[model samples]
Target: MADFNPGRDEVEDVAAMKREGDLSRFLRQQIRDGQARRDKPTAAPKPAPPPGYRPGAWPSGTSPPGPLPDRGADWDRALDRYRNGEGSDRDPCHCGACDTPDNNQTEEN
Candidate 1:
């Protein structure tokens, strides 16, 4: 068995404080601290791009290329081939014999 007490006074104090209330005061304090931290301004906004600058436009003033070509038919063909077991090289026999049942019975004669 391991010793649960790691001997951290600050952690123990916080735990004791939370236990003193129904944890409602501790939870409210956490929320208020989070909100205060978030409300503090961090950095100034980025300056706007120069006038007549088209976002993502090429240097030559051409628009960005259109969407890629559709490959749905290729995907459908691959899925169909997989479902038909076309590429599997594993042994198909579940029983001991790889041959048909008639061949097995004849060989036993």
Candidate 2:
């Protein structure tokens, strides 16, 4: 078995390697390689966002598709109540979509 001595200062050699050698470059290259292997960009990419997630999917950029279907009458009424502050004091539908079809930028015939 090889004898090891702690007082001889093995860390000095490591410090020398870190400073003069390409050890840092070698370590960075290894890390980049490992990441490339893990990522494997050549593999299939994730599916694009759904129709609802697309840009301008709704009148408001922030509005998400609601649990309520696009029943225009109910949407209008809800929007009216929300505008008048007749609904909950919290203003739940203030996101501008009214959780249904848009009341903004619409005309009733």
Candidate 3:
């Protein structure tokens, strides 16, 4: 028959219980407690931290700074340019995705 070998502390505890003539009672209570523990519902796992999360980098009740607020007039001007078909005041983006022949043609042409 397979036997469960108790650890040293448990062996000592069992020996003490045996001497006190209550080893069976102690084991029955331990078994009940173990079953109770196994039957209890487990809590949900904690969520993983977000990418590049740094613990305690900011103070409690405060968060890291967010994106800067848009400059109202600058946004209005840029929106107007888009509405009027006027290109951006800044140089045209040369990224291949939106490259156009018209973007290459200058006012001197």
Report the alpha-carbon TM-score of model 2 versus the true structure.
0.23
Number of clashing pairs per prediction, in order: 0, 0, 0
Instruction: Write candidate 1's Cα lDDT for 1-109 as tens digits.
Output: 6765646996787678777864788779888998988866679899998877777776555667899999999999888766654444431543333454432333352
Q: After best superposition, candidate 1 residue 27: deviation in angstroms?
A: 42
Error of 1 at 81 (Å): 0.4
Q: After superposition, how far is residue 70 of candidate 3 from its true place, in Å?
A: 91
Query: Model 2 over residues 8-108: C-alpha lDDT tens digits?
Result: 46567657668898678867997999888894548678789765664645654566756967699998998887675554434356544354434333556
lDDT of each: 0.66, 0.65, 0.73
Q: Could you arrange the candidates by lDDT from highest to lowest?
A: 3, 1, 2
What count of clashes does model 2 give?
0
RMSD of 3: 14.4
Q: Per-prediction RMSD in angstroms?
A: 15.8, 18.7, 14.4
Task: Report the number of backbone clashes for model 1.
Answer: 0
Q: Is candidate 2 or candidate 3 better by lDDT?
A: 3
Per-residue lDDT of 45 in model 3? 100
In model 1, the runs with Cα more than 4 Å from the true position are: 1-56, 61-63, 91-109
- Candidate 2, which segments miss by more than 4 Å at Cα? 1-16, 41-109
